[model samples]
Target chain A: GIQVEQSPPDLILQEGANSTLRCNFSDSVNNLQWFHQNPWGQLINLFYIPSGTKQNGRLSATTVATERYSLLYISSSQTTDSGVYFCAVASVYGGATNKLIFGTGTLLAVQP
Target chain B: EAGVTQFPSHSVIEKGQTVTLRCDPISGHDNLYWYRRVMGKEIKFLLHFVKESKQDESGMPNNRFLAERTGGTYSTLKVQPAELEDSGVYFCASSQDRVGYSYEQYFGPGTRLTVT
Candidate 1:
């Protein structure tokens, strides 16, 4: 079983601030995704980056697969961005089975 | 386009009771998954279905939990004789493909199941 660890178990930022969330995996992965669990518990897909960089609105993510880690960046954060962010990885051995090993999660709180 | 949808946003049952949670994936999506987040724990994978076939069910906890995808459309997860430890938030997600191109998994709001 692969292990996924998220940094800064809890984070607090003021509105309009910027922050970075990090995820480290124990082994190489063929699939990695960033998800935001909204206040209502809807897991919103933020990015699917096994490697390289991708940007979506105010949110962006970069995964250094070789290094076995990923970083999620939120710019001009807003109160609505407050929620738990999770990084899930799919092992290459398991390949396309669709089973995702999720990190504990980074709990972000953006205060207005 | 419609996203993944789940029924009975919440459920409460006593130990030994049976409960079925349903999930309706996006119309054209071919992959559906069931995940659970127990209290104060990270989300854990339960199973995956490619169309009506169970592609991977390695994450299933035990025989008490059964999942089904009927006609390659909607899916259901039944927890029979639910135990106290079975209480958690169940999330259903669906992606567009099985291989290549990392597709985003659209998730449902989730069904909060409380077993007393």
Candidate 2:
């Protein structure tokens, strides 16, 4: 099984600030995603970037498959962004079902 | 339209009791998966279903936990004689495709299970 590691175990940012989170995988993966666990405990899919780059609203993500790492950027952070950010990836060896392996996650706090 | 939907947003039961959780994937989505996150731990995969078949259940913890998908639409996870360790949040997700190249998984809000 491949291991996923997320950095900046904790973060505190002011509203309107920006932050970046990183995820490093032990091996190559077929699927990578970033999720925001909100105060209500809902896991909102932020990005599904196996490789290349993608953006939605003020959030962006880039996965460099060759480097076995992915980065998530949150710009103009909002108070609602306060919660845990998790990075999960599916090992290529896991077959086609796309079962995910999650990282420890980064807890983010956006202060008003 | 509808994303993955899970039943019983929260459940609390005594040890040795049985509980069943249900997940209904988006219409026409062929890939469905189950995952769990224990207290203070990262989410872990439980199993995966491709339509009506159990594609991969390698992540399942033990025989006490059973999952089934009938008619390739809705799925259920049954935990019998539940233990204290069974307390956690179970999440269900579904994707547009089973395999090939599409790998996005849309997750449900999750069902929080607490075995007392």
Q: Number of the top candidate by DockQ?
A: 2
Q: For candidate 2, what is the lDDT?
A: 0.93
Cα lDDT tens digits for candidate 2, B1-116: 98899999999999999999999999999889999998869999999999999998988999999999999999999999899999999999998883465788999999999999
lDDT of 2 by residue, A3-63 (tens): 9999999999999999999999988898899999987778999999999999999999999
Q: In candidate 2, which residue pairs get closer than 3 Å at backbone N, Cα or C atoms, i.e. clash?
A: none
lDDT of all predictions? 0.92, 0.93
Quality class of the docking in candidate 2, CAPRI style: high
- Model number 1 iRMSD: 1.5
Candidate 1's displacement at residue A34, Å, is 0.8
Model 1 stretches astray by more than 4 angstroms? B98-100
Task: Write down the worst ten-residue block by lDDT for model 2 chain B.
Answer: B95-104
Restricting to chain A, the TM-score for each candidate equals 0.96, 0.96
Q: Which residue pairs clash within candidate 1?
A: none
Candidate 1 lDDT over A1-112, as tens digits, reads 8899999899999999999999999888877999999887778888889899999999999999989999999999999999999999988877667578999999999999
DockQ, candidate 2, vs. native dimer: 0.88
